[model samples]
Target: MPPNLALEIKCRESERQALLSFKQSLVYRYDILSSWTTQAKANDDCCNWIGVGCSNNITGGDYHITRLDLHNTGLMGEIGSSLTQLSHLTYLDLSSNEFDQIFLEDVASLINLNYLNLSYNMLRGPIPQSLGQLSNLEYLNLQFNFLEGEVSEVHFSKLKNLKALDLSDNFLRNCTLGPYFPRWLRTQNFSVLDIAGNMISDKIPRWFWNNLSPNLLFLDVSYNFIKGKIPNLSLKFKTMPVIILGVNEFEGTIPPFLFGAQNLDLSGNKFSDISSLCEVNYSSPLYLLDICGNQIFGHLPRCWNRMLNLASLSLAYNYFSGKIPHSLSNLTRLKSLNLRKNHFSGEFPSWFNFTDLIVLDVVDNNFSGNLPSWIGLRLPNLVRLLLKSNNFHGNLPLSLCNLRRIEVLDISQNYNISGTIPTCIYKFDALTKTLNASEVPDYLKDLVMMWKGKETLIHGRNLQLQRSIDLSCNRLTGEIPNKITELVGLVVLNLSRNELTGQIPYNIGQLQSLDFLDPSRNNLCGENQDRLIVQDLLFAISSGFIIGFWGIFGSLLLFKRWRLAYFKFLRNIIEKPL
Candidate 1:
């Protein structure tokens, strides 16, 4: 080999030794880099190490390290300064690690980096402003970190080529005087941007939305303290595909243009009305819409049939009244629907054919009339049905047993509803067996239920694959069905405050997974009552015998002549009762 080629090989070996030193400083539980241990034997090259890659130098130069991906490798250590040795690195990922107190100054030296991810780490302290020096960066993710302090313009001003940026779930707060919108982002072009779960408290500036880059497609600012109303959006620019402004303090009517977004989330606010959204000409590819936990009132408008792409719709915890618009049946793609905690009255709307419905919650409403038996026939995929605290009356339709996938069923607090619970309740297959972990969906319906005598808020994975049956606070009469004991996977059972007669099922103990059980304030009696009577009788007999024997014995001991007469009387009583 040429003398210059030999010198290049020696230099590359030195850089590899530096990287091995950096790994030694970490606390790795798994042997993800078993090849890293072969360096001492000179049998392995640095480029062949796990999570390491080398670049092909076509210019007759030595190959340099270009990529280092150690994501979810169970590494626990400080991001040591030794990483600066890999000057030619273009991609670096150390996400889902336990690296604390990172030295961003060391990372800033990698000027050729194009993508960097440090998410899901124990990083603390301020994001170094030296990161702005990486002009070639295209993607940067720092989510799920303990990073604190402000993020000034100096941290990203030079990164004009950045396409995606996420800084969510951090303790970083904006120290601005007015609006939380960062002024530095006005000039940069970004396709995806997320700053959720931060301490940003201010009104969104009017210019922020109007001046958004035409390439902008997704924006998330949820879970902040942002206040004030959103200005009328201009349609002159390209329409955004996704926008999330949920869990904020913004109050006022929702903008009509928001309905045009494919995925829009405006839940947990004080918006009063959304009728304008229906009045507008919505022609975008709408998918998911969430406006729950608001004070929205008025009947749902009838102009929603055109959006055929809708899947999940949530308008719960609002004041919407009157019947549901029948035109909603046209959207055949609907999957999940929530209208709970409203003032909607009159008979339940049985017009819509929800063939793909999975969750239906209409709790805490003034809905009256008998529950239609067509629920199972119309919605075969139903899993959770919550209709409690309503005025519905009449016997539970036996056809409800046709819902084989039902997991949660609550129809309690209907004062006029009467009759025995159906014996075919065990047919609910979802509640018959213990739900496997894989059967639980990632996102389930959210409902506020009276569980275990307390109001419980359940949703998402917490409510997934859980079985419960609530039929309390009603005027129903008849025996508690013995078939209910067959539901070995039942999680909660409530039958309190009812006029039902007959004993609780003898096999109630068969529900091994039953965590909560309430059968109080009912006219039911069973072995429990018999046990109480037997205990009382035994106590009475023992007390009377103890008192009478002690009274006679004390008298005999006090008087000598009486003692002799008592013995004679006992002998005479044994012979004859008089």
Candidate 2:
């Protein structure tokens, strides 16, 4: 071989060795990628490799790896410093993997990384301040992990090109706004930002809204302890924004201008009157509006129809009253409507129509009259129907059985309705659990009995019983249903405070899952002394039986003549009912 030919061969081999070194570094840095064997790397194909993207060079020499994504691969080792060798890498995603505390320092070396996601991992310690070096980064997601640190303004003020930032679900504590929560962030082209589920408390800095650029499209600060009134910001952005400020301690009325947002969620706040919202025109392309779990009062805003593009509306746990607006049906795209735990009084609106409706929760309201048969027929896609604690009269709608996909159906507190529950309810494949209908009307007494039953006396594990039924505190009369034993999943039975008579069914013992039993305050007579003794013994063993002795002695004394003596003593003080 000539010297020139030998030199050319040596140069080619040097380039090949460099490429091999880079590939080996990637495998060593991430534990999951280490599985790629030396044989697999020998293949002359770069495009077919897993989790790597390669683009052909304009000179047609070789393909260069442009992207590397190894998300959720259970990689349980410290990120090695060798990753910095991937100089051509533009994208790196090591999200949802376990890493040690100091890995962030090594990650900071990836200066060219534009898209970096390290979310949902067990990485701990303060976010390395060196992250500020990534000036080219556009998208950064570090959510749902145990990353703890004080996210100061200095830490985030440097990422000028960042468009999306998610740091939710972290142990970040005592975070105070540093000269306005990275106010420089507004100057950049950020569209989506999520900083929820942190210990961030303090009045929402005014600079957040004042400096917010119209280019901002999505903002989420939910599940933080933020307090103070929501800021009223002037709209300057051409596109409507989606804002979520739920699960905070925010007080005062919601800013009416917020209605202009496309997706606004102010739920779980201390707001009182949202009537100011009626003044705002909802002509914007709003999609979701959630103000649930607040002190919001006043009637349903008739202007709701203005938001024709609305898809989900939740105003539950408020003091709203009067009829639900039939105008709501105008939201043809509506899929979810939750107005539970309000004072709204009126019959179910006949005009409520939406073929795409999936969730309808109007529970615990003052709504009266019969259950609309057409509700089930109209909302065939309904998944959750909660109409409990209302004044609804009439029998249970048999048409409700038609909802094959319904997962949760709660309509327990309407006293005006008479007759048995539709047995077809048991046939729904999606019905995984059902609350006892009898417990709602007389909830206080039934709750006490339920509490007593949970006392450790039953000594059984995973006992299956009949459906809990509480028909107490009503006009219900007649012997206790013997068929109750057929409901093998029942856990509680309360027939107290009614005109129920006749001996207690002996088959009641057949309900092995019957943890709670309350038949007091009724006309039911007769006593199974042996059964009562066993129940007392079980209760004693489970709960240390502090009161069982007193109960048994009191019952025996009453049976003897204590009641007659008490009556005589009362007769001496007052005139007898002769």
Candidate 3:
């Protein structure tokens, strides 16, 4: 932006007043609007204001504020009508705010707008038909909103100059834009297009595959009912694009040409064999490939050694059988691997070459034999280790204590594992810490899990359980480990159905992060059960408080009896004897 020296003489008074009216219709969490004042003392300059950019007009009109970017600012409320008054605006972004829907209905009046983003807001209702009037728009993003209903050609009638369009995470479903694929999409060339999670159900037309933009670098149409096989478009994309078509009804084998992309997710489809994995030439640049929850089966592919850049691979929830091939161990940079819910059997190969693993999930399979003792040493950075419902047997490995960064460890329901719980369990350092939902690590969001007794596949983000250990449903004998209470970050602790005898740890209440706990069906019985239950109930309440004082524990808030009883429990723990 060029320097704005003369603010008063250059800025048009009417446009500056329009900006003030724009600020009037909203709520502000900070005094960020102080510079937008109309007071004479502050110079009443709109062009020099924060987030406001002005440019000299070719016709020599007053310097007009051509840009207004207030993304992620703490502004909330409905879109003001005064925005349309700034007719010279060519760039505007009001994303990631607690904002409105009416803006779309009037934003089209700014015909000069070449870039616009209102994503991650509280906008609702049908997308306004007037948006089609932005003929010069090159970028438009309305992702993460509540807009819905059929999207017709009227929505994009004059948007021929559009280069990037993202309408992800809404309830929209239609075509003309959803009984069929958008017929008009083939006309406009897009560098980035994301229409994921809209209920558009139709086969991707062949013309779309033929006329795919050569400049396309990102295309996501996942989480819908769209079908038809994805064709190989390696030659179409001049630069490798990140393509995601997951959770759709697409059928047929994945094309080997897709391996040419930088990142690809064809998971949750009917794609048959990954024989294409072997067809790709060595030195493949693919870094992430998730084909999980498909019907692809047969022995594990042995060509993983070819893709040296492959770091994250997820093939869970498929019919894959046979031992994991040794070639998979060749990728030294492998970080995350998910192979759960398959027929993979045999003791986990003790010779893994990839030490960069942060997430190693192989749950609910038929793999047998003892848990590998070398895992803790081989993958020191392992954060999540899930191996539940497998046929693995034998005592818990003491070497697991060396995993200081382990946050999630589920070695449950493998009945044959026996012996006392390790006393060095406190050595798993990450469990001893605490974190709220918003503070959760980015990579952990890749998981889909539910809390409480039922473990279902739901996108984890809200009230989802994290951290903790699950060593339940085993033949392990001996007393409950008292040192386990040191793990203040443990969220779900299920030690039920084990032969463990003795009293519950008195300091178990120290686990303030416990969301779900089950010591029932074990030999942990005594008059202390009431005391322990009450103590854990308080922990559950605190856990609920950590993730916003609502959800999952609402019964205590809504019912008077439960509310009084909770207060009584609190009074008892304070005044009465145990």
Error of 2 at 502 (Å): 7.6
* Candidate models: Cα lDDT each: 0.75, 0.62, 0.76
In candidate 2, position 430 carries an lDDT of: 41
lDDT of 2 by residue, 1-578 (tens): 76553222111223334334545433233454443334434343333445766554679654556577878776555565555656556798878666544367767887888998988777777787788888888998886565664676566677888888887655443342322334455555678888665445767667666756677788887766788887666664566898888888899977777777888988898888776656665475778888889987778777776788888888888889999887777899987787877899989888877888767778678998887878778888775566756887666677877776654454545656554445565444443334423211110111111223342221111111212344333434456655444444444444445445676666666432232234464565555646854865574475444335443455333332233234334444654455
Q: Point out the worst 10-residue segment of candidate 3 by lDDT.
A: 436-445
Clashing pairs in 2: 438-470, 465-488, 465-489, 465-490, 466-487, 466-489, 466-490, 467-490
Q: Which prediction has the highest TM-score against the true structure? A: 1
Residue pairs in clash, model 1: none
Worst 10 residues of 2 by lDDT: 439-448
Candidate 3, superposed: residue stretches over 4 Å from native = 1-8, 12-31, 37-45, 57-63, 73-85, 97-106, 121-126, 146-149, 169-177, 236-240, 434-440, 446-464, 478-482, 501-527, 533-578
lDDT of 3 by residue, 1-578 (tens): 44654334566778888888988898989988888887643255677778898888788655888999999988899886899889999999999898865567688889999999998898888888889989999999987666766687778868999999988655342221465678778768888998775557999987877767766789988766898886765553468889998889988878777787788898889988888778776578788889898998898889988788988888989999999899987788888889989999898886774678888888888999887878788888887888888998888888888888887788888988998888899897877767633233453344543245568442234324567577877888888778888887776677777887877677675554332234565666433556656776776576557644443255443433244345435544665656
lDDT winner between 1 and 3, please give it. 3
Say which prediction, candidate 2 or candidate 3, comes out ahead on lDDT.
Answer: 3
What order do you get sorting by lDDT, best first? 3, 1, 2
How many clashes (backbone atoms < 3 Å, residues ≥3 apart in a chain or on different chains) does model 2 have? 8
Positional deviation of residue 472's Cα in model 3 after best superposition, in angstroms: 3.1
